[model samples]
Target: MIGKRLKRLSPAIGRAYIQLIMELDERISEISATQLQKQLKCGPGCDGCCIQFSVLPLEAAIVAEAAVAKNVNAENNGESCSLLKDGLCSVYEVRPVICRTQGLPLAYIDEEAGAIEVSACPVNFPDDYPLSHDELMFMDSYNGRLAQLNVQYCTENDIDCSVRIPLADCVC
Candidate 1:
């Protein structure tokens, strides 16, 4: 369904969406290689955090297109993400931004607390592990860029940017 909707949109918008995701993936790779690889416990077959979630229309469209191309069907086990098959993501290559940064040192502003908080998977990092500012992946910057791209895509495609589509619906 999302693929069909994307067909009517401008190809340029699609390219931009893909470019943003690619750039994010590259950043994640660089971080993993330079800093997080030793502490990162995430790897294939570790689907503990593969839970169901919603995504923006631009993200849904790209994931849906990839699923369609790969002839993969989402199987909702009612406990985890529909995109997971045999404990691995069926559409791993084109997964959404959130999935790309899982288990990494994520930093975001805690507005209510008026400070920045950094977090990572407990299994990946010990409770006493000291997180460094330089190693933290500040999410706000990337999320802001994604929001900008999403707005452009949604405006052109007539999608409600505020309405997030479930990940399962993307595959369907």
Candidate 2:
């Protein structure tokens, strides 16, 4: 299932897939934001979860292109994300995949434990509102699809496949 259409994708098609994935993630985030607005503390000025994190190489590559176009630096200061400027994400328009999931109910299927681990920021879920597993955003499926797309991208571009780079490293 992974490599069925490996080399069939052109860079243009790969870019389209990346855009579609980003749109889907944004749509899901919007749903969560609307449904849990009362319980969610995340807002424009909230950078609580904007700490350093890694993103897939494909994400980094895309963001790197944006960084150059925007004339913004993507350096890592070994503190908070270098993208933050004046308490806001400088590259918010092209933020990485992990940045899109902050302050949302996220679920991960642990195969070894055979259970779905669900969690969100402590500020969320204060009202004991029951959220079904299907209601939460699942990372496994998203990540798998991303990996598949990344494989196609790498294959088409002759880049290394299956690599995760620090967000800072990707830009500069």
Per-candidate local distance difference test: 0.83, 0.69
* Best model per lDDT: 1
Per residue, candidate 1 scores C-alpha lDDT tens digits across 1-172 of 5555653336887677677777777877877886568989899999888999989888888888888888888796787999999999999988888999889889999899999988788998888888777677889978988898888888987788887988888776
Instruction: Please provide TM-scores, in order, for all candidate models, with all chains considered together.
Output: 0.89, 0.78
Candidate 2: global Cα-lDDT? 0.69
The clash count for each model shown is 0, 0
Stretches of candidate 2 above 4 Å error? 1-10, 26-30, 75-77, 126-130
Report the lDDT tens digits of candidate 2 across residue range 62-134.
6666666677776554578877776788878778667877777888999999998887776766547687655
RMSD of 2: 5.8
Give the worst 10-residue stretch by lDDT in candidate 1.
1-10
Top-scoring candidate (TM-score): 1
